[model samples]
Target: MGAAPSAGRRLGWKAGLSAGAALLIVGIAALARHRAGPPARCAPGMVALGPRCCGEGQRLDDAGRCAGAPSRCGAGLSAAPAGCVAPGATVRIAAGTLRLGPSDWEAQGVVEAREVFVPAFSLDAFEVTEQRYAACVAAGACAALPLRGEPGVPVTGVTLEESARYCAFAGGSLPSRNQLAFAAAGPSSRRYPWGDTGAVCRRVAFGLRAGPCGWGATGPELAGSRPDGAAVHADGRVFDLAGNVAEWAAPDRPGDGMSGTHGGSWTDEAASALRTWNRRLVPVSTRSPDLGFRCAYPP
Candidate 1:
C-alpha cells in the first residue's frame, strides 16, 4: 500500500511538470512572433496583430495597415470619426498677422492690407447657431441675438455683450479686434487669408460685391465652404479665418462706440473689404441679417 501511494505521487508530479513546460513553450512562441513585427494580415483592416486591437468598424487591409479609424479633433474641439469639426468648438492655428485692407481709400473704398502680429489662440469652428444660442438664453447665460429668419439661419443682430455672453457660457471669451484679425490673416500680411490676391475670395466668406450696402451679398455659407479656406498646420490648427458670419472684436471702442466686425459678410463685393484689418463699426445695439460672431479661447 505504501508503494502504491508513492507511485501515485510521482505520477502527479510528472503531470504538473509537463503542463508547466507546455505553457512555457507557448509563451515563448508568442513572444518570438511579437518581436517579428505585426503578423501577415489583410491591409487597411483592424486586426488583433498581437496584444493591441483596433476598435470595431475598422479592419486591417491587405497591406497589414489599419483602416477606417476615426480622426482626432484634439481638446475642446468636436469632430466625427472621419474628423468633422463641430460648429461651436474653437480651433487653434499658428500665430501670424491680421491684415487690413488699404488705408489709401480715404474717400471710401476697399482697403489693401498687410500683416500684423497675433498671439496663438483657438476660435469657434462654426458660427453660433440659433439652437446653440437658444440654449444659452434658456440657461440665462446670455440674451437672444435677434433673428429675422429661421432659427437655423445663423444667429445675427447680436450685441457685443450678447456675443461675449455666449463665449462665456462656452468657457471661452470674445476675441478682441486684433486677435480676430490675427486669426483671419495669420503671420503674413496677405490681402486674403491664403494670400494677397483676388483669387482668395473663393476661399473666404464674404460678399462678391463691394460697398457697405453689399452686406448679405455673398450669403452665409458653412464654416469651410472654400476648398482652401483654412489650412490646418502641422500642429493640427486651421488658418485663413473667413467665410461664415463676421465676428465681433473685444475691447469695445468707446469713441466709435461701435463694436468691430471682421471677415467679409455675404454682401461684400471687393476683396479689399474682406481683409483681416477691415473694420466695420456697428452700433452695439444693432444686429443685422448678415452680422454674426464667433468665439475664441486660449490655447
Candidate 2:
C-alpha cells in the first residue's frame, strides 16, 4: 500500500510539469507570430507621430500633443502673420494705387507711384494656373476661362470681378492699385527688382531671346523661374515681382475704367520696360495672353 501511494504521487508531479511546459510553448509561438506579422499601415490623411497617428500637415507643435481638428487654416484662419493660409489659397489684394505711370512717349514714363501700406497678407505665389482655375470653375466659384493647352498654364481671360471672387474664397481681397505698385516697387526704388544693371533678359525678365535691339518675342514662362534673381523678404518669402507675368491691380474709384497692371510680362524689354516704378493701365475687362495676377491679403 505504501509503494502504491508513492507511485501515484510521482505520476501527479509529472502531469503538473507537462502542463507547465505546454503553456510556455504556446506563449513563445504567440510572440513569434506578433514579431513576424507585417507592420500596420498608416491611414490616409493621418501623419505618423512616432508609433501613433496625427492630422495631416500638422506636427507635435513643440508640446508633444496632437493639434486639434478643423485645421486652423481651414476656417479662415492664418498660420502666421505673413505665412501661407493653406496649400491652395487664392491670392488676395490689400490696397489700391493712388497714381499711375505716365504714358507719354518721353519724360522717362515714370508712374509717380504712391505708397499704400499693406498689412501682412498672403498671395498665390504662382499665378492662377489653369488646373486651379478649373477647380474654381467646377466649384462654381468662378466662370470657366478659356485655355489653349496644358492645364498647368496660367489662367488668362479672367476679369477683375472673377479674380476677386477667387481671392475672396481663399480669404483675401483684391489688391488696390496702390498696394500692387508697392509690391512691385519693393523696399527701395530701383529701375527693376534686380537693379539697373543691364542683365540678361532670361535673368531679369521672363521673355524669349531678344534681338540686337533688345526687343524680345512673347512666350509664357514658369512662375518663380528666376530663382537666383528673386527678391527675398526678411521673413524668407521669395517673390517674382518683376518677371513672371503682368498682373492686374484693382481699379481706383468709381468710373475708373483704367485698371493698373504691374510686372513686366514674358515679352517685355529687360531695361526700361521692367522698372519697379513702371505702371500701366487698361480697361478692367481687358485680357491678354501674357497678363495674369497675384493676390495680397490684409494684415
Candidate 3:
C-alpha cells in the first residue's frame, strides 16, 4: 500500500466528493422542475397544478414538480376517472339550463314537463351502490342500508330523508328536478337519455318496469351492469340517467315536507315515467325499494 495520507488531506477529499454528489442531486431536481412548467399546460391527459403539469398517477406536491401522491377528491370532486372509483362517481357537468318538460310528452298525474335553468353542477355517473352505502354506515356517516343489496346494485329501501342525509354525507345534495333533467336530457333536451329517439337499443335503464311499458317490463338488476349504456351529455360524461331506479329530488318548493322522485323504476312501465319531465311527489319520509338517489355538487 502507498503511504497513508494526512488527516487534513482525507478530510478535503471527502468534502469534495460530498459537494459533487450534492450538485448532481441539485441538477436533477432542477431539470424536473423546469420540465413541469410549460409542458404541463399543453400536454394531453395532464392536469394543471399551479404552474406545473402532472402526468398520470402523479399530482402536484408542495415542492411543485408534480411527483406527489394524490389524495381522493373528497365529496364534490372527482378523481382522474378510470370510470368512477365508487358509485357512479366520475365526470363534471357544467352549469346549464335543464329543460324541465318537453313540449311533446304528455304530463302525468302531478308530474309536469317544462324548461328550467339551473346552475352548473357535477353528478355521479351511476347511482350509489349498496356496498358504498354500507361503507358510509360503517364510517358513521350514514344509516344502515335497509336490506343489504348486492355490492354493485343501487342501494334501495331508503327514504327521501335518508337519501338527503346520504347526499350530505357524500359531500353533495339531492339533485333538483332541474339538475336531474339536464343530466338526463342534456342542454338540447333529447327526449330519451339514449338520445332524441329510441332508435338506439339500450339495456333496461338496467331494472324492471311493472306497467304497460309504452317497452313492457320492471325489477332490480345491477348498477353499472350496462357499462356503455349510461346516457351521454352533449358537453361531457355519461349518466345512468333513466336507469331502473327513480331518484330523489327536492320538489319545486321546499319546507313543505313534500319532495319529488324522478325517473322510471323497476315497477314503472308508463311511457311518461321515463320522460324528462316525469316528477312524482312523495312525502319526505317515504321509502321504496325502487327509489334511489345520487348526490350533486354546486359549480
The number of the candidate with the highest TM-score is 3
Q: What is the C-alpha RMSD of each candidate to the true structure, in Å?
A: 18.2, 19.6, 18.5
Better candidate by TM-score, 2 or 3:
3
Better of 1 and 3 by lDDT: 3
lDDT of 3 by residue, 44-150 (tens): 33343443223345554443333433344212223433211234455577777766544444543344555577777888777887766877898898888665333
Model 2 stretches astray by more than 4 angstroms = 1-109, 113-118, 196-199, 209-218
Task: List the candidates ranked by TM-score, beginning with the highest.
Answer: 3, 2, 1
Model 1's alpha-carbon lDDT is 0.56
On a 0 to 100 scale, what is the lDDT of residue 248 in model 1? Answer: 76
Model 3 regions lying over 4 Å from their true place: 1-88, 105-113, 199-201, 206-219, 234-236
Candidate 1 positional error at 11, Å: 99
Q: What is the lDDT of candidate 2?
A: 0.53
